[model samples]
Target: MKFLGSLYRFSSSWVGTICIVLFIILFVAQAFVIPSGSMRVTLLEGDFLFVKKFSYGIPTPHIPFIEVPVAPDSDGDGHLFQGKRPQRGDIVVFRYPKDEKIHYVKRNFAVGGDEVIFDLDNFYLRPNEGDEFIEQNYDKSDIVILNGQKYVKEPYKFKGINYNPHFRNAMRASMLGNLERKSLAMRPIMVAESEKVYEYGSVKFNAFYIKVPQDEFFMIGDNRNNSGDSRYWGTVPYRLIVGKPWFTYFSIDPDKKIRWERIGRFIDTLQSDESLIYEQK
Candidate 1:
């Protein structure tokens, strides 16, 4: 009772309440609003969600809005605590690799030592020794045994992953090259360093094969066709990862109609729709 009373009294005070809220936002959980349509159908433009800050680790506390650093990085890894790093299939909320102040939410498609290939308008991933997992879990049709290695097609079975039907069964050009990241992935002339390239017949042309370096992750949006993801940008360092989104506390459409069904729904729950389940075979 005494501890409770003390906490209550502290929180009732202006400075104490502000500090408590800052502590929650910094170390525990933080409210994040979806600001773009990149993750549409799964997380919408107006969806309101809370980021589980401790999901990865406790980042260096920053003052709200102003974003001024409040403390020194203890481990020199941008986190106060080192926790589990991101893995494949995790929906990650992260600082934009290009701009740390900007936050972005994308599905972690590939992690370190993984080879990601975007070819022929299809997404293919060669996990580091991923063949064993594919052989065990994926349908044979979805697993392509190519050049004595295994590749999985669209391993993430999220229903929100939408592709125009016409875009499928189509030949697409692909180009990828070295990542020159200083503070972030530096972008110059993309074609200058592209050694591996393929030509295809279509206005829709995208090609590249890049290896996710150690301590980096590849992110892609659920709205594949409309999103600007690692395809256009570059891989994200684990230090840049902030947390995982927990749930939708509120959601509204462009017209401002409340999406009653989405309120209080878990992100994983929204993704686990049976209709979204994919065998691809």
Candidate 2:
């Protein structure tokens, strides 16, 4: 009885409180806010969410603002405890490769060893056949037989994925682009590791065929044409993966309007049911 009392007193002290909070933030959950439209129609801008850090693995905790590692990665993969890697079609949060200091969130479009081909806005994915699930359940319309192999289209099957073709590459000419070149008005371009030849939209564009490197993943935004993702920045290494968005504790609109329906909602719950999130007005 005396030992239990002492232990309780220690846990309630400031040092113990700090350790407990830090452990939750580092290993269990971390807060992340959506700052861009890249994941729009699924995860909107201003959605304040918590990332379940352990969804992938328990990574070495960094001192929050400074981003300095608190300890060395014993597993050599930045994770303190080895866990499952992000699977296809999961919304992943990770440190951006070009700038490890910054965090980025994007859907896992393709994982290591997969081949991705794109012509303008349309996509063709040739997943590594090693994943039997892809060979078994991938949509029929998207699959094409070529030289005794099969390829899938818009391969990521996340229901909220925006495949609306009418949304044009006009953004490269307007707000999204800062350059003053003719290519700005042309179709979207993806400079993949490998190149395929194709033309679209009278722009005579060269297609991109990327082979995702081992231990890396190719990320794409659900808002396809509008996002600057793997097409521009390249694939993400597993070492940089942080976690998956767990829930939206709070959400707001550009005009500071409170989104009542979205408050305290889980991302997976919203994704599973389409009819709930649309504006009632």
Best candidate according to lDDT: 2
Give the 10-residue window scoring lowest on summed lDDT in candidate 2: 178-187
TM-score of each prediction:
0.81, 0.82
Q: Name the regions of candidate 1 deviating beyond 4 angstroms.
A: 1-4, 165-206, 274-281
lDDT of 1 by residue, 195-249 (tens): 4444333222234566889888999887675566887678988788889999889
Q: Assess candidate 2 and give its lDDT.
A: 0.75
- In model 1, the Cα lDDT at residue 176 comes to 26
Candidate 2, residue 275: Cα displacement in angstroms equals 3.1
The 10-residue segment with the lowest total lDDT in model 1: 171-180
Candidate lDDT values, in order: 0.74, 0.75
Candidate 2 structure quality by residue, lDDT tens digits, 184-250: 2123443443255444435433555578899889888887767778876789988999999999999
